[model samples]
Target: MILAIDAGNSRVKWGWHDGADWASIATVPLIEFAASSDHINPFSITHGDPERIVIANVAGEGAHQLLVNWTSIFDAEPLWLHGEAERCGVRSRYDRPEQLGPDRWAALVAARAVHTGPCLVVNAGTATTIDMLSGDGVFLGGAISPGIDLMRFVLHEHTGRLPLQEGSYRDAPRNTLDAIETGCRHAQAGAVERMHRAMGGNPLCIVSGGAARSLLELLRLPSRYIENLVLDGLARIALSERAVTR
Candidate 1:
């Protein structure tokens, strides 16, 4: 079995694969992931005894240390994914490949595997990332901006008037709570539209991450939402690496 973990700024997503298919999936708060004792029990779940573990973590604080400690409990060496020139059927076009975020790289790999033709992968999480992949598999650079929660956080933190607002999952804003929600929604929607236009009109857009559904509801363009894309990408990477070694 392969264990795939995506440790982002806000959440930790995990998936278990048994060589044939993804057997189970779960998510937890980022801060709670390392402290959760339940994860240490290999036989506690259906997919028992993960042979390999892969992780894509963007949080720089105690995240790495915690991940290393947690994986050590299972006597597994967790593979920390990083941006590279080429890996898992996707290549980085950045001048300094190492500078690219692992989250984005993993998304690219997963996007190429699941979708055909040119694609724009929009990850709306702690930080919104828009990445473009060419029809022929070339990875073109995209954009990044403050995500929904970040925007709301900034509004409350930096200003005295704007209250800390919770994200609304609904489509239309009706009241004050909805207004703040809609603001964040439009903020993301506008960016997506701009990127879509810059990429030469329409492309197959794939939205993922915590804020994916909210952004999708606000946007006018056609899109498909896939949760745990980073974990899926990690799974793909593990499988690809195994094939190479064989």
Candidate 2:
């Protein structure tokens, strides 16, 4: 079996895949992994001794060492994804390819595997990122902005009047809560609409991550929601590399 881990700023997600299909998946507070190893067993969580473990972590505050230690429980070497011009099944066009986030790369890889046309992948998490992939599989650059949570956090942190609140997609905000929700939704929707315009109106927009559904509900343009695309991408990369080695 293979295990794929995506360690983000607010949460950590893990997926397990047998040779033919994904068997299990789950998400937990990032703090769980920071706990003592005796508190939870990595091998027990996956229910298998993972042959290979791949991680795409953007929240790099001792997480690398923590993962390294956890994977050692299975005696498996950890493969940390790094940005590259090309790797697995996707190519990057970032001016400095190394600067591209591994999570973004993984999402792009999954987008290409699922759709064979020009695509705009929007990942809404700690930071919202929109990445474009041409029909021929060339990764054109896209955009990045604060995620819904971050935007709300900034408003509360920067101002005394605004309180930190949850974000949602609502057509009409009748009250103050609704007003905040509307603002966040509008910000996300506006960014997506701009990308749609840039793509010339005929590209597949694939939204993923925790906030995908809400963003899709607010946006007027067409889009598809894909959950756990990063894990799928990691699985694809691991399987492809495994086949090549054979």
Candidate 3:
């Protein structure tokens, strides 16, 4: 059994894989865990212990230590993944390969494993990252921008009148709230379309993260949504020959 953890900016997601497939997958908001005084291993209650545990953390050192403390009961020390020059059939083209985000690296690895052709990997979370992978398993770099929530947050924080409110998407928004919502959503979709066009090979966009559904209807390209993409990639890395703790 292998436990793979993705400690992202806004949430902590994990999956339990039994060599072949996932036995269980779970997600928890960072705030929920942070606020709780008792840091019990939530998954262990239902799924029991794992023989090996691997993690890809992008939530800074504080969260990293929190996770270390939380998973202390497990027998295996958590194997933290870092972006490498090449791993699991995917080669990095970035000048500073190690500087690439672990979540993005994991996603690209997962994309290469599943798709042979050109791929546009989109992870729409607290911040959105759109990465391009070539047909021959080469990661050709990517773009990063504020995600939907961050867009909305900046508008509210930077401006005096804009309040943090939920509004439905509208093509031609008449109200202020709707306009804000539409503009943010449009920004996300537009970036994706531009990247897809720039990638130039009619790449299969593998969409994941919390805001994936929001962009699905807006995307015009051939896109597939995987709910637990980072987790899947972590599992693949856990089983790979090159998977090592940094």
Candidate 4:
């Protein structure tokens, strides 16, 4: 068994897979653990003694220590993943391959594992990232923007009059709430579409993350949503490492 963990800006998502398929998947609200004093075992969401525990943590030092403290109970010491020039059939074309976010790197690896053709990888969570992966397995760089909620929060935070509230999408928003929602959704979808166009080939857009459903409705391109993509990629990396060592 392999336990794959993706600690992002807002949440820590994990899954258990037995090489063939996923046994279970769950999320731990990262915000809840603001301090080490607020102890919550995120791993208790499911019971599994995984042979390997692989993680891609972009949540910073505090979260890292927390995870280490929790996962220490398991026999498998965590295998932390970092951005690399090449791994699991994906080559980085970024100016500084090591500086690329591990979440993005893992996503690219997972995209390559599932799709053979060119791809536009989009992960829309606290921030929306649109990455390009060539048919030949190259990480061709991409773009990042504030996610839907962050967009709304920024407006409310930076501007005094703009209120942060829920709203539905409309072709022409007549109210403030609708306008905010519509504009943010369009911005996310537009970034995805623009990256797809820039990639040129008839690439498949592999979308993931919390806000993906909203973008899915707005995007008119060839796109499909994959839940826990980072986790899947972490698992793939783990399996690859095991094979290499053997």
lDDT tens digits, residue span 109-226, model 1: 9999888778899999999999988887778888999998898888888877878868464566677666787788888999998888888857888999888987887778878898
The alpha-carbon deviation from the true structure for residue 223 of candidate 3, after best TM-score superposition, in angstroms, is 0.8
lDDT by residue (tens digit), candidate 2, 1-246 = 889999988788888989777898888877876664655755466476887788899878687787776777786777888677987657888999988888998888889999988889999987889888988888889899988888888888898788787744456777765678789878987998898888774898999988888889877776888898888888887777788879
Query: Model 1 reaches what TM-score against the true structure?
Result: 0.90
Candidate ranking under TM-score, highest first, comes to 4, 3, 2, 1
Residue 145 local lDDT, model 4: 94
Off by over 4 Å in 1: 34-46, 167-176
Whole-model alpha-carbon lDDT for candidate 4: 0.89
TM-scores, each model vs. reference:
0.90, 0.93, 0.95, 0.95
| Residue 49 alpha-carbon offset, candidate 1, angstroms | 2.8
Please report how far candidate 2 places residue 102 from its true position, in Å. Answer: 0.6
After superposing candidate 3 on the true structure, give the runs of residues whose Cα lies further than 4 Å from its correct spot. Answer: 242-246
TM-score of 2: 0.93
| Residue range 168-213, candidate 3, lDDT tens digits | 8987899999999999999999999999999897899999999999
- The C-alpha stretches of model 2 lying farther than 4 A from their native spots are 36-39, 167-172
In the predicted model 2, the residue pairs found to clash are none
- The predicted structure with the larger lDDT, 1 or 2, is 2
**2 or 3, greater by TM-score:** 3
